[model samples]
Target: MSTTPDPTYHRPVMLAECLAALQLRPDGRYVDVTFGGGGHSAAILEQLGPDGHLYAFDQDADAEQQAQQLIRGPRGDRFTFIRANFSQLHDELGRRGALGLDGLLADLGVSSHQFDTPERGFSTRFDGPLDMRMNSEHGPSAADVVAQYSEAELHRIFGMYGEVTNARTLARTLAQARNARTIHTIADLKQAIQSCVPRGKENKYLAQVFQALRLEVNEEMEVLQALLTQSAQVLRPGGRLVVMSYHSLEDRLVKNYIGQGKFFGEAEKDLFGNVQRPFESVTRKPVTATEAELAQNNRARSAKLRVAERSSLMLS
Candidate 1:
């Protein structure tokens, strides 16, 4: 068997844009919650002075292993990697006496390495086990989701998360197919759902199906909500919340939370009708990749970066 080292990571989406969005401080405290391959974390460290510190969080063992390489660097002492989900941001940072963050950065979505690796199963192009958990060791695998979820539950995730056009049909198809045999691998899933795919839209439809399964298997939407909620409480006044998301669902949540301080509703109004919110929106609109950047990295095409700042006055 070949023992090739996996590539370090894909070029970070919107590298310059993300850096600018953070508005770095020489003595500030920062967090890179999605330290995939440590691209952005390394860059942030480069900008920090001796007093500045960075704490990164990732649950993936591969990512935690990769993080070790940074600890041996010249500025290693200034960095810390918490091998847990960013949803634990509050307690983890508090434990280290690292609260009152100056800025927080989250590059949300599966890392390129995870998607490209066949066994991880985030992509539809591979014929690997249907395991899509971000942590890999914990939670139910995508196979478990497919095999155990009732048709209605599968339908809910497919329609709500994937926005698959034929979500109902796809869910019913999987429900019936798995009844005959286990949909245990990527090939098994594709073959089982072949009849439900549209003729010329095979790739797009499968992508949606895979996306829905991945999101549900990982409980991504819930995790993101937890992270956003905790970020507001942790950031100090004027602290930055820089987030880059790949899909409409993630972006919508980020946009809403920053703009309204709540996930689904308007900001609450005080007695004087002053809108009370956690973070103030920095980007009037979501920032997308430039034509120049897009030419260099095709994956940057779907990226949407949104920056926000903790309100000057703390909210209850």
Candidate 2:
């Protein structure tokens, strides 16, 4: 039987900050939505006494298995692992009869495992197949998008998500290349991108392309919207919704959701003077990693943590 190692093995991003934002209550219920390496879950468990219960959710089967091993230890009974995406949090919590959560956490973006593993296709450093599905069992691979999307659509994805300077030119290049032959591997894709863009800073250019592809492959923006909506609903009044986003696109969405219930804009008040908005922004500005943390973990540099508390507003 494999042994459950210490939480250090996973290296939870901004661990101290997340715990502080959570503000754990010994007797209150808590949820860790992205139980990637169980680092956050283990930390939350440590804070919980005998009566406190922690429910965790992770779509990846491997994450579930690791969580199972951790839960089987001394603190086993208090831990519950769910094999599902955080977007369906409301329904899943309802089915489990959970309510009035003390705190909820979502560590968004890709995990270390995805980037470290070559076949996952998240990193530009690896020369693997262009498969970037978070859940390999479902959804279209990154290659599918490159092979199928129209030039205009590809340009939009690269420009919007990756912030590529020459997205239009790159998109046209990709379209022409695909017409001639298929792009099967990361090396092939990188070479195609290099042909369009100059040789200087190749890694930066390739990274942006990969970012655009991964974001589209995972449908990250759509999934984030659903998860954030569910998080607001599932959290009880005054319950904290702590989210750590790695990219500006996601951080912007989180900021808007916290300040105003919708992404379009904050709701305007009528002459009747009725208030609107489901959550109150706890952090007006997103919190970033400390210099110390950034020095230790380069990944923390891109991490931005935004917190919100549930309000009395009822869904219409």
Candidate 3:
């Protein structure tokens, strides 16, 4: 049994890009949907002179608690931390009379806190229990998914979430191994995978397996879709929707939603021959981190930032 690694300080991805995309107004209201280390939130607060209000959301109990402590300075009252999933962001803000935000920032991906914490079961480097719930209070454990999900279901999960090359083979292997033994711990699951998966890059393969399990446990993609759909309605006209996605699956969703206003193709055209995209793409291509940022943070390698401004299209 190996001891857990020390929790490293989390650096927000594309800090400058996030701040610029928000287009902060002195009196504007803003939302940081994934306030991991509260870096982005703190930046927004700095831009907000006095009348600006910043509302941050983090589903993870640990993150929420940390955010409460982190925002304890002079500008504390201006920043409100909500301990709930951002899928229902609009409703949560609406209850507090926060309608039509001036801008919104959603750094959509697993946080460093979740990945570093051994007990969270997000990282393969750590030998923790097979638990990967973002909220920590809800959802089925990764162990349950590994033990209960059918081979086909597991295959779909790995293929969709992790983009694992041998998803089918891995899924079948998990299904076969788990039936004979109760796969309760992360070590048990990793060993089960290793039995079928030939070791080349152990870390890479384990990362994929862990990522698949985490996505299945948290339903991250589905929640992201929900949040994106709500963004068009919640943001004021000319308000910006800036997002940072770590993977292609998430980037595709963000790209499509911004361009077509839905996950699929564009809606029908009017007599004026307008394609009717609800949000105009601010950056034709996703903005990536600079060499300076990448040199300091390995996690920024996969980060892609997309920005869009709300169109005149009213909520349907």
Candidate 4:
């Protein structure tokens, strides 16, 4: 809103690359589906003409506050912030009679502000409540997952989401530990599974454990899949889908959806054997932050960006 981003908010990762991928048209309509700190949303607003409109979405209340601040600022007239998850993109837009967007951008992974806030419990670096809810107001917190999930449920999430090596041991340890004491905070969870963590890789091990809990609590994968499926439906022909994912799991889903039009399996073919795909990859490989960006923003280190363009051919 002030034309200057809050220093504590997320710094846009690979900003230049993402803007270039969008190929912004002055009068085009675009959506920034993960408006963490309004970094990308503000940038998109800059590219839009007075006739252009930008819709930003976020489930986080903190982000909604930031968006409200932006909407009261200089370019407010051209921007609208939807306080909802991107998974509801279609319905939200349709309700406003706004569909067929020219482009959509999603920068995935936890925001810097979320991770840095000790109370949010996203980072292992801090000792705080094991909350980790992006929206914060709804859904089960990470503490709930750690305290209530069965050994098998914990094992499944840790193994599948975090890809932790000793997930089984960690899950068993947590189930046993929680019975003795409530795993209500980061410190409690860490102490509970300290014995299961690989000694030399404590940081990485704890990160994986936390990641599993965070993903399960938020249903991140399911939400992401929903957003992708809706993107194919709401984007106009030749519209761009620019997504930046932080982990391999998200990147794999983005890659498969763009290349195959499905999260799994091969692309379906028509009677003539022509593949029926909704979008075509603009980037054959996921782009990463340049050394210059990485030097300035350590958070960009794990970011993987992919771009796709909606197919011009109509589906039967």
Candidate 5:
């Protein structure tokens, strides 16, 4: 709605690079799957012709409210807000005749607003309820995972999702502690696992633990796989898939999907040994924020962007 981005809401990370990757056409249809603050959605609407449409998807109520504000703007008719997760991309788009998209952009990771809000429980710096569900209304909270998950399940997610070095020990410690007292808030969890945190490295260790719990609570990896798989079906030949990931796990999946058409192992091959793939890599490597951008936005430091183009060759 407004040209100026709301710093309090979210500052679009690597905006220039994302737009360039999209290669926007005035009459082309586009989708911004993670419309946190409507910043990027507004920018896309500005570049679109009257006939071009932009569909934005976000399950967060706050984001839905922001989309409503954008819908009341002059470019309202060209914009559609779908209050659903990107995992439902294909079905939602198909219903609106948005299939064969010109391009799709997904800036992955929690938004700045979510991270800064204490009640959202995304940040370790704040003391709040351990509720990290992106949709909030659906699924078990992080507290549920901490209190009910077995030691083995906790170990698996911590080591696999968080990449925590001392995951086994941390899981065992948490299992024992939860038996004695409730772990309902950020402060409570921190105190419960105080002995497990390495001295002088408490912040980093706490962050990893929280990240693991948040990932599990939201089923982020599975949802991301869904988005990547459906992206191929929604985009037309030569349509772009531009994704920005904040952490290594997400980046790895995006990279592998673009290069191999599958998240794990190698690409499938046809009878002639020509590799069957849905997309070809547009960016040989993940792009990082320039020093200029990093100087202005500290959060941009961890952002990594990758782009790919939908392949014309048919695949089973």
Candidate 6:
């Protein structure tokens, strides 16, 4: 296994852009909800003074290990690493007596470390165990989802989460194949649904299938909703919310929540006709990677960054 301190463990996407979006205050408290390789956490710590505090959260044990390395380093005193999903943001902050943050940053989706590591099973490039849980120690793995979910359930996940075409057919195929042979590995899954994949779109097809399973196994959409809802309560007035999402599903949720303070439906209005919202969007449109950043890191290609600020009005 590679050492956690290695910089290449996971190269953070859009580092400068994220920092600029936060508009950090040297003495303010901040949170990095997805401290994958501690890259963003470390950067946030750099801008902080001795009085400032930075809380980092991640459910993955590997991430926790990387966080420990950061904690033991020179500026460790300024950092607090929480080993929990960002969905538990509110409770975790309350437990630590660290509510009302000045800024909160969430770099959503699977980290490069998770993708590059074959055993983690997050990448389509490698053939490994179909286990895509961010926190490998808990929850059902991708294999469990593929092996257990009904055809209907599978179809729903593939269609809604992965946006897979012919999701029903793919789900039925998996259901039949699993009964004949267990779908435990990445290779097994690909072979099981080989016939369903489009002639020239095998990679894309497999990605959709894997994405659906990963999302279901990790409850990503629900978790993202929880985080966005809690962030409204946790951030101080004018506090920043910076989120970088790789996929449209995650980006849409962030965009909608930031714009209207709710994921589904339009914003509710007061009797006076003023819209009541928790956070006002800072970036009118989602920001994407620059050509320069894209050249250096191909992963940045799909990233969409959105920023918002806590509203001062404090709606009931």
- What lDDT does candidate 3 reach at residue 264? 75
The predictions' CA RMSDs to the true structure, in order, are 2.6, 1.8, 4.0, 1.2, 1.3, 1.6
Superposed by TM-score, candidate 3 places the C-alpha of residue 25 at a distance from the truth, in angstroms, of 1.3
- TM-score for all models, in order of appearance: 0.97, 0.94, 0.94, 0.97, 0.97, 0.97
The regions of model 4 sitting more than 4 angstroms off are 1-4, 313-316
When summed lDDT is taken over every stretch of 10 residues in candidate 4, the lowest stretch is 1-10
Model 3 residue runs over 4 Å out of place are 1-8
Q: Which model scores highest in lDDT?
A: 5
lDDT of 4 by residue, 1-316 (tens): 2654575788999999999999999999999999999888888898899989999999999998888767887888989989998999999999987799999999998999999999999999999999999999999999988877789999999999999998888888889999999888899988898899887999888888888888899999999999999998889999999999988999999999888888998898889998778999988888999999999999999999999999986754
| Ten-residue stretch with the least lDDT total in model 1 | 1-10
Would you list the clashing residue pairs of candidate 2? none
Report every candidate's CA lDDT.
0.90, 0.85, 0.85, 0.90, 0.92, 0.91
User: What's the residue-level lDDT of 229 in candidate 5?
Assistant: 94
User: What TM value does model 2 have?
Assistant: 0.94
Per-residue C-alpha lDDT of model 5 across residues 1-316, encoded as one tens digit per residue? 5633365798889998999999999899999999998888888888999989999999999888878777888888889999999999999999988899999999998998999999999999999999999998888999999999999999999999989999999999999999999999999999888988999998888889988998899999999999999999999999999999989999999999998889999898889988788999999989999999999999899999999999997654
Candidate 1 achieves a global lDDT of 0.90
Query: Please, what are the lDDT tens digits per residue for candidate 3 over residues 1-316?
Result: 2111123536788998989888899899999998877777877888887888999998877777667654666777788989889998879999999979999999887778778888888888888989988878887999889988889999999998988999999999888888789998889998888865656878877877888888889898899999998888789999999999988888999999888767876666669987676799999999999999999999999999999999998666
Model 1: clashing residue pairs? none
lDDT of 2 by residue, 267-295 (tens): 65557865477888888888899999889
What's the residue-level lDDT of 156 in candidate 6?
A: 99
